[model samples]
Target: MNAFIYFPVYLVLKSEEEYAVYYLPTDFQSPELFVPRKPLSDQAKRAGWQGFLYDLSKVPQGAFIRIV
Candidate 1:
């Protein structure tokens, strides 16, 4: 079976800190990223960036022995 999904990316940053991170996609087929914090929050906004296409096929398949 083949499955695909859109993975939203976010720009997390503080006053002087910044880095790219992965966010979750909304159920409506569109992702909504919200940043709520201190002064940094003001600058934190949707980067309007596109998510990369992740291919699960590249991952090695293994037996699931544990689930928690």
Candidate 2:
């Protein structure tokens, strides 16, 4: 069996009228990992911090993470 890592991501949409954010969990490891090239934008960087805080509040204890 293959193991997968699910990363919680925040999708931020900015429009002239308003800004919206959505939280989603995505499987980080898969056969299709190398094909797509989706990089984070500057706005994402700002939103990421907020997203992280949100995820941390909800994630259960003892979750393993590696920092590089």
Candidate 3:
């Protein structure tokens, strides 16, 4: 069996863009996954930033597995 690890992510908003910042442990490894989705809307992107703080509070730190 394979073991899985999770890293912390911070979503920062710059203007109307949402950026995902990943926080990893010293031994953390990056995943090799690809996304198959369309892009996000301008409004949705802005909202993502505005709600980042709230979302972080609810989710476990370093437990963010994925983002789209």
Candidate 4:
């Protein structure tokens, strides 16, 4: 059997009406960057100091919302 572990990505607010996506790979020092190629959800607007999880492959509907 094959085992798999899924990690979390984040939708962080950079500034007003602006945002950036960060992929926090396990044990990695610096987070990988992913461009927000599409329109974001309302959740993104609410992303404060504690950014929300934007897990992609793990979400049943291919993610709760699109950020990239």
The global C-alpha lDDT for each of the candidates, from Candidate 1 onward, is 0.33, 0.43, 0.39, 0.41
Of candidate 1, the 10-residue stretch with the lowest lDDT total is 28-37
Candidate that scores best on lDDT: 2
> How many backbone clashes can be found in candidate 3?
1
Cα RMSD to the true fold for all candidates: 14.0, 14.1, 12.6, 15.0
Off by over 4 Å in 4: 1-6, 9-11, 29-68
Q: Pick the candidate with the highest TM-score.
A: 2
TM-scores of the candidates in the order shown: 0.22, 0.34, 0.21, 0.25
Evaluated at residue 30, the lDDT of candidate 2 is 35
lDDT of 2 by residue, 32-57 (tens): 43233344466784443321123343
Query: Clashes in model 2: which pairs?
Result: none
TM-score, prediction 1: 0.22
Q: lDDT of model 4 at residue 49? A: 30
lDDT score for candidate 2 against the true structure = 0.43
Candidate 4, RMSD to the unseen true structure: 15.0
Query: Candidates sorted by TM-score, descending order?
Result: 2, 4, 1, 3
Q: List the candidates ranked by lDDT, beginning with the highest.
A: 2, 4, 3, 1
State the weakest 10-residue window (summed lDDT) of model 2.
48-57
Q: Which 10 residues in a row give candidate 4 its minimum summed lDDT?
A: 27-36
lDDT of 3 by residue, 1-68 (tens): 02435444444445566655444342333333212244455678454332111223434455543343
Task: Summarize candidate 4's per-residue lDDT along 1-68 as a digit string, tens digits.
Answer: 01324355455648787776644444332222222334455578644333333334443433334455
Deviation of model 4 at 1, angstroms:
25
